[model samples]
Target: MLDGSDLKSVRKNAGISQTDMANKLNCDRRTIINYEQGVCEPKSSQLFRWLDVC
Candidate 1:
């Protein structure tokens, strides 16, 4: 599973905002916030999409 902090770090390093990531991943901005905040986890497909975005 992808670690939330690592996910946040990757997103930050990629210079994309949560909204940008959400748009790329076809998810809600709050989902990105939840993932980054460790409030929830993303599915494997979402992880792949995130990898593609980054």
Candidate 2:
């Protein structure tokens, strides 16, 4: 599973902004920020959705 930092890196490398990621994940941009900051972990389903994006 991808860690917070790893997710951030993948998003960056994919040229996806936090807002865009949030849109795709059906969450707020702050949620994406929180994920990157290690404030909380994404749910398994959410993580899977993100992986689908990758």
Candidate 3:
């Protein structure tokens, strides 16, 4: 599973807000925020999309 640093780095490099990334990936901002905070991990499909984005 990706760690919080990976999530934060990818999102920052992608130049998008949590909300924008969530919209593109069809999830909630809280989900993305949780990911970046290491509060929770993404689901399989969400992980795939995150891979695509990063």
Q: Give the top-scoring candidate (lDDT).
A: 1
A best-first ranking of the candidates according to their lDDT comes to 1, 2, 3
Which segments of candidate 2 are over 4 A away from where they belong?
none
Error of 2 at 19 (Å): 0.3
lDDT of 3 by residue, 1-54 (tens): 679888788878978888889898988888888988999888778888887876
Please give, for residues 3-48, the per-residue lDDT of candidate 2 as tens digits: 7998899889888999999999999999999998888999999988
lDDT of 2: 0.90
Scored by CA lDDT, what does every candidate get?
Answer: 0.91, 0.90, 0.85
Kindly indicate the candidate among 1 and 3 with the higher lDDT. 1
Error of 1 at 32 (Å): 0.3
Please write out the lDDT profile of model 1 over residues 1-54, one tens digit for every residue. Answer: 657999999989999999999999988999999999889999989988898889
- Report lDDT (Cα) of residue 44, candidate 2: 92
Candidates' RMSD to native = 1.0, 1.4, 1.3
Error of 3 at 4 (Å): 1.3
Clashing pairs in 3: none
Off by over 4 Å in 3: none
Instruction: Estimate the TM-score for candidate 1.
Output: 0.91
